[model samples]
Target: MSRRPQLTGRAAVLAVVVCAIAMSLAYPVREFIAQRRQIAELQQQQAKELDALRKLRDRGRQLQDPDYTMRQARERLFYCEPNQKCFVVMDRGKAPAARKPGRAPKPKAPWYESLWKSVELADHGVSR
Candidate 1:
C-alpha cells in the first residue's frame, strides 16, 4: 500500500499541471479584477454626472418660470415694477470716523539744494 502523504508520480504530475494552469491564468485574473474596479469607478462617476444633469434640468425648469425670473431680477438686479417705487436708503446715521494722528515722516531737502552742495564740494576739490 502506498503512503498517502508521499507524493507519487501522478500526484506530482497533477500538482505541476495545476500550478501551470494557475500561472497561465494569473495575469488574466488580475486584469479581470482591475477592470472590475475601473468599471465600478466609472459607474460612480456616471452617477455623479447624472445627478448634476438632473440638478441642471431642474434649474432650467426654474428658469422657464416667469415668477422665478421676476424674483431673481428683484433680488439680484433690484428691478422695480412700473407702478411701484423702490428706494435704496443709505445708512447716513453713522458719521465718518476721524483718523487718529500717526507719526509724520521726516521732510527731505529739495533736489536743487543737494545738487548745489555737490557742485560746491567739486569746486572746493578743484580749488585744493
Candidate 2:
C-alpha cells in the first residue's frame, strides 16, 4: 500500500501566503466597513440639519414681513390696532359651582398678633 503526501511543500507555501494576505487585509476591510457606516450616519444627520435650516430660513423670511409680524403679534400677544376696540371673551361655560352651605374656613389672625402670642407662649413655657 502507497500513501500520497497529503500536504506538499508548494501547497504549504501557497497556504501560508494566502493566510498572510488575509491577515494583512483584515484590519483595512474592517475599517472600510466602519467608515462606510459612519458616512451613512453623517449623511442622515446632514439631511436633518438641512431640513431644520430650511425651516428656519422660511421663518426668517416671514419675520422680515411687517404684515406677518403684525399677525403674529395679534395672535400671540392679543394686540389691538389703535382705535380698534378689541374685547376678550372669556370662557364662562366652565364656571365653578357655588359651595354648599357649611362652616366657613376660619380667617387667620394678623401676623403681629401671632408673633405676640408666640412671645407670650415662650415666656409662659406653655403649649396649647
Which candidate number has the best lDDT? Answer: 2
Give the TM-score comparing model 2 with the true structure, all chains together. Answer: 0.73
TM-score of candidate 1 to 2 decimals: 0.64
lDDT of 1 by residue, 24-128 (tens): 999999999999999999999999999999999999999999999999998888899999998865566887766667956678999999888889989888532
Choose the strongest candidate by TM-score. 2
The residue-by-residue lDDT of candidate 2 on 27-114, one tens digit each, is 9999999999999999999999999999999999999999999998887888999999888767767887677689686899999999
Model 1, C-alpha of 117: deviation from truth (Å): 20
Query: Runs in model 2 with CA error above 4 Å?
Result: 96-128
Kindly report which residue pairs in candidate 2 clash with one another.
none
